[model samples]
Target: MDTPPRVPGLGTFLDKNTGTPKPPTPQLVTVASRLLLLAAVVQVVASVIAVVYAASPARLDAIQLQIDAMTGSTPSLAMMRNLGILTVVISGIATITAYVLFALFLAKGRSWARVAAGVLALLTVMQLLGITLPEGLTTVAQIVLGAVAVGLCYLPGPNHFFATVKAARS
Candidate 1:
């Protein structure tokens, strides 16, 4: 009796009948991809809201008041506003990059992407907290969507999907 060929470093064997990689990606992973994409969109919206509201004079004054209360020193409004803009732009870029890039890799059935996405989901919440008021709606949407998206990948079906891909690729 002959055994199937094996990929290096993977416990998975080639399909006995086809002598190739495993089957196509499962539906759960596909849904995860879509959910992640939706979350990415919401993040983009929230970033725009942050830029708009974080730049407002009243918002800056409110932030200044908080800073004064905490540190007892007030910086110039222009400096504070510039810092806010820089923070938003850098964070927004990083968040969106992680969401979209990891989602794509997850869709492709990358095993590492599954773990990376979980980390991204957690980190994303920290960023969402910085969103300005009224942007809270989008932030909440991202939380829900991102939670569900990452959760789905850990389901049995997706696990199998990822394992097959791993064994096949490895």
Candidate 2:
């Protein structure tokens, strides 16, 4: 048995080099992985767009006004601008990182990736109500693509594939 302090997605589960060839990944898993990757790409573009939009004078003023209304005080334009940009950029980076990791592991037939991807997709869809235009459209597309991708990983073929992967990993 392994030691107590093991990370999940290391050499054992991902790209395990058993002398035996792995069964070919199912088409559904392949599609799901690719779709997730595509969604990550779209998310990257949207994040960049958001960063630019968030930097706009009108946008910064709106943020300042909203904060002032809520708290009766407003931070300097530079501070608020930096925070606004940082907020979206940091969020985008974290999400893009997750998507890439999930996609890679999903391609490797990691069942947990499917579940995580599903959760991410669900959360993305849930935020649809608050999304704005331009970047919002891409966010919507990313959500749809992510949902479909995660859904594919749950289909019969991929279900069996993930099970087999689990067996091999053990």
Who wins the TM-score comparison?
2
> How would you encode candidate 1's per-residue C-alpha lDDT over 68-95 as one tens digit per residue?
7775566776787888988998888888
Candidate 2's residue-wise lDDT over 1-170, tens digit each? 98667576576445655765677998889899999999999989988998989899889779777777765565777888898899999999999999999999898878888999999988888768877776689878988999899888878888999999887766
C-alpha lDDT of all candidate models, in order: 0.79, 0.85
Candidate 2, 29: how far from true, in Å?
0.9
Candidate 1's C-alpha runs over 4 A off are: 1-22, 63-74, 127-133
Candidate 2 regions off by >4 Å? 1-17, 67-74
Q: How many backbone clashes does candidate 1 have?
A: 0
